[model samples]
Target: MNTNPATIRKGRKFEQVLEGARDIFLRDGFEGANVDDIARTAGVSKATLYSYFPDKRLLFIEVFRQECDRQTLAALDQIDLGAPVAEVLRQAAGHMVASFVNEFNQAVFRICVAESDRFPELGAAFYRSGPRRLHDELAGFLAGVDGQGEVAIPDAALAADQFIELCKADLYLRHLLRIDDSFAPEEIARVIDGAVATFMARYGVRT
Candidate 1:
């Protein structure tokens, strides 16, 4: 098997382009960004940008995927599935809400909502790479914890999904709507507390 150095180089350059595009998108809304700006931001010429991404829409999708994957992994990877079931659930909820509230994440989310109809694929990519994957990971964790007698649930996967939805339902909605001035530390605490309470009511180990 022969390795193509050009292909390897192109792959690396594509990664760089995604990073540059993410930064640009964060600094400037999607409508304000362009291939010329992305190429300059990536430290590549127009030729290189077009080589990896023939169109701005394709490049935007790649950038959205890269960012969504990074955030989803970072949030899910921090959970310690070995911890006590209650702790694990709390940690997952805490991490998920915190990551979602992050300025960059919120910005990306706003951009998706603002342009969802115009760029439906970007929204679809985010949903698949982010929440869908997190749900899978959480389901696995919940199933493991259920087997350990830390929680009792008829459906671990459904419980995991519900747990996250409980945590973010109110807070996430407020943030998304820009109705909240800012997230006070105490507000996060309130969300966490409410989420944990709901989780325990549904799945706590009945002693």
Candidate 2:
């Protein structure tokens, strides 16, 4: 699959283009998104839009990238790195669940999966910006705390993955399967506490 789109060039109208693209993509999906509509909404000529993003696929990926970046930054800004271990996990897990269960993100995931065979880059891009980035950040946090003797994680990467998977126990899967949409705060708290206890049981220092 020639999923790799052309290089995205940044210009003065870049943000303007993305602003328009975001609205269109949200309203109409990747396949349904029209370049003409994108240009019209962005308030730029076809030539201008094409100059920044050579192909539709590239533009789509770039939009997802920017949105994912904003979500990640927002999550990170809420986290206090120096906080206690359980509290840190709670905050991170809450954000992770919220992001995964987001309607727009779910739509993007379905679209990317359905289209990935034709454009392999879409699925890979989402994985990179979403789960992979989350894993890396969690692993870094675990490693930092382990060094300080707060946790005993010898393999931070593995532990990080475990923690994330724990957060997804049933709610995340249910949402993806279309079995359910709304989850009460107590349900989320249950998963968070379960994850924290399961993790602490193994890695907590018994001092």
Candidate 3:
């Protein structure tokens, strides 16, 4: 990653376009968002926009992909390599829950779920870009911790998937459906805490 000024400026402009496109898509849905409106929102000419993204579909998918990547990266930052497996897993689960509660995540997740049928590419791109990476990173970490006999997971990938599912099941589906009920902080804490406890009961180090 070189730190050239021109590259930095272009990157910033591209990010601006993605932000604008995301806002438009959330407000108007994919079919209603126009490239010209995105360009105006980004304060760039349509020509400049094309120089970055060739079409609205690509731009829209990238916007959602970028949002997913941002959330994944934030969660990645919280992993503590030196911590015990159960502790690390608890932290990871908590981070996962907190990430979905963010406003940007709620909006982006809504768009991804709603447009998944019409824009399969967008959904595929999101899985490839975000959840796939998270799964890989989590599996890698679990392998390390398992090697230390801190956990009993025979297959880290399966364990990671299970962990994600258990942590996200109700939270994700409810949020996607716009369910009126909201999880209180205490409730969220309990959900994540219980998930981790159950995982440890199955996988934690035995005396």
Candidate 4:
């Protein structure tokens, strides 16, 4: 919100408008979302909703970016950086895996792909708020760990990218392709554990 886009003023009711837009967009989606509903939900008049977002697509994109930020950046704060390398990796992987299988993300992915041609910003927004943010977070953490001699990652950025890709090994593609939706705890554990082991094997400092 205010963190980025300084031009877009955050009024006394800015968050209120966004909250309403989020509710309507999630419940009804881009095409189905109406300004009237968003305004009513936010308890603001139509003028207020229009004042914040001149177009519905803009509102939808903002909400999508907001959700992605919430999912990736906010959740990163909860991961205990002081934990052992393996445990820290597991914690990060666990959150990543959950997001991969989450309904909101799945829906966002579907909508982005479906409407990408018409609303090209959807892809860019997703990348910026989701994968890009996550990558930076992981890369920063790995670099610190490497500096501390806890890991042997010569290329922290590359290792971060690889770790994220490893977590997407099976379930991600399947779920995105609509092959499977069920997220079994055992399956998730397997993915998380394998990602951690593989990363550690490559980067873990030999004791």
Candidate 5:
């Protein structure tokens, strides 16, 4: 059982490349970021960078995927499964809205939209990593809540999507278009409140 220092160093460098690539992608976006700059930022050679990512498109996809995973997990962690239906929905909607309107997320979304026509795969990857995952997670949660007879959702997946769309409403679109770059805490709360109320009205089981 001999330990290889070369293997350890390669692993360390791999992580550094990912970290540096993520920073570059966030700061410069996919179209603006370059591999040479990424290599320099990561303190790695061009050969090493390409060995890990193969191409800039793959690197951008990896960065977005990692970010989506991190943000989704962080937001879901705020939810309490045991909480009341309205309370749980409110919390979940709040997290979803906040993430959707986040400056970094908005930038990534804009990049995906702007480039998707030329790079269809990037759009698909973004949707799969971000919205699709969130939908699946929310559907699972709603299904469990329905099982408890707290809600009357016939199609948990549809309900999940509808709830998320409701949460987004005009706010996400307005933000995306630069109609308004900032959302006050009260505005966020109001949007979440409306979404939760609308969802509960449709799906809640009355006594």
Candidate 6:
């Protein structure tokens, strides 16, 4: 389809605001960030910013959605569906755990928890954008794998949730609590391998 120049320009400006708002939110947090600074950082007028996003919360949600789509959900597209099921699970679990344990993601999760009482929708918005979306994507993958007879998953969605939780294990909790700031590569690998093995033990088809 052909593009309109004005629409293209508007889209570019919208992206600029998103980038600026994300930086400000990450640096100053949801309550601390202000529209004036976001506009200034974005090199756009306050009117322009408001025209695109009427409120700070909407802008924050957009930023969060972009981050979730880019960092969390996009990884699923990289998996080779033709590969061995165990290998695919390991790769997918690795991506999920790695995304969850990162500093940026942990901060986002903390923001959701800390603000949920005041802005109850914030938590729901985050869940829909991040965890729920990831779960759905993984569920779809598992269903496809099951259809191929690679795994015997009677309930693909439940199995997806279980596998992701197994991948998180205690490491994600430790990171969230600031009890541990980092994990070794070997530790991550071990976690992914164990998660895959556990899932297979429960769901793999018999010979």
Candidate 4, residue 135: the lDDT equals: 91
lDDT, candidate 3, 1-207, per-residue tens: 222223322455888787778778877777788888888988888888877776566776677667767777776676776777777888888887776566666765566777889777667766776678778988888877775776877999998888877788567667656783478778788878888988888778888
Quality of model 4 by C-alpha lDDT: 0.82
Best by lDDT: 2
Ranking 2 against 3 by TM-score, winner = 2
lDDT of 1 by residue, 28-127 (tens): 8788887778888899888888777666666665666666677767765777766777777778778888866777777877787788997786677667
lDDT digits (tens) for residues 1-207 of candidate 6:
112112222455999999999889888889999889999999999999977777677787778888987886468578776799998888888788888898877787888888999887788888999889988988998888885666888899999899989989878999989999999998888888899989999999877
What is the Cα-based TM-score of model 6? Answer: 0.89
The TM-score that candidate 5 achieves is 0.89
Best TM-score goes to which candidate? 2
Task: Provide the global lDDT of candidate 6 against the true structure.
Answer: 0.84
- Quote each prediction's TM-score: 0.84, 0.90, 0.85, 0.86, 0.89, 0.89
Backbone clash numbers for all candidates listed: 0, 0, 0, 0, 0, 0
Clashes of 1: 0
Identify the runs in model 3 with alpha carbons over 4 angstroms from their true place.
Answer: 1-12
Please state the error at residue 9 of candidate 3 in Å.
12
Please identify which of the two predictions, 4 or 6, would achieve the higher TM-score against the true structure. Answer: 6
Tell me each candidate's RMSD, in Å, in order. Answer: 4.6, 2.2, 4.9, 3.1, 5.3, 4.9
lDDT of each: 0.75, 0.87, 0.74, 0.82, 0.84, 0.84
For residue 104, model 1's alpha carbon misses the true position, in angstroms, by 2.4
